[model samples]
Target: MNRRDNAPGASADIGAALYGLATRAARRLPRDMSLTSAATLATLDRTGPRRITDLAAVEGITQPAMTTLVRVMEKSGLVERRGDASDKRVTLVCLTEAGASYVRTRRQAGVHAFERLISELTGDEVEALVAALPALKHLADLESQDREGQNQ
Candidate 1:
């Protein structure tokens, strides 16, 4: 049997293809917004309010850097810093209504672009992809868990 039949290489090739597709799709987004800022807003919108320290941890950035990012985002009306009701000293970062809308808009654009890209695929290929969605979600969860473990 030839080495070309190896499963690991095929899996790596699939991963690289997916990564390239995602990178290209991300490039289609608005140039005015940094990917980090967009990601932060989307995270806040999806997860609700979080402390600045926690947000920094989630975003894998330094606390001071996250502070600067929050300040800029706040000025752009994409995020708001509000004092926690239980502890007035603690500030919680939450997405503004406009931020939530912006996230939704960006998500829609990504979906549209992905759909258009896959429009040429055969029905069987589409069905295979749909069937793989659950496994893909599980893989994502596993990856997130690994990252959290490493952080701790």
Candidate 2:
């Protein structure tokens, strides 16, 4: 039997469709930026400076792995490390201006790509997608809450 036959609600169908679209969209993105690097940059840009441990947690990576990733990003001029003023023992990682600009450029490129694809969709399909976005966001929030609960 088809999996959709076992699924309930338009939400499930929409979610699966969106997931497929996102997978294809990610494949279409420029090869210059890795998804992890883009995610790190976007997180830093949105949240400002963070300790390496915190960054690792946000990125869902091991501390040592995050350390290595940060070092690689540092070498590429995307991030900089500075001493935390209040906690002299702790170091804060932040995006350089170049990193922020790079993230913005990549985001714009992704948006443009999506917009082009969206433009091809019928008006009713676009309306359906727009209507689904709020529920999708809520689902994401629910999943995050579930993770947090599990962690605690």
Q: Which candidate is the best by lDDT?
A: 1
Tens-place lDDT digits, model 1, residues 95-130: 999999999999998888879967989999999999
Candidate 1 steric clashes: 0
- Evaluate candidate 1 by giving its C-alpha RMSD to the native, one decimal: 3.5
lDDT of 2 at 103: 87
Q: Candidate 1: list runs displaced more than 4 Å.
A: 1-6, 148-152
Q: Rate the local accuracy (lDDT) of all candidates.
A: 0.86, 0.85
User: For every model shown, what is its TM-score relative to the native structure?
Assistant: 0.85, 0.80
* lDDT digits (tens) for residues 104-131 of candidate 2: 9988999898889899999999998899
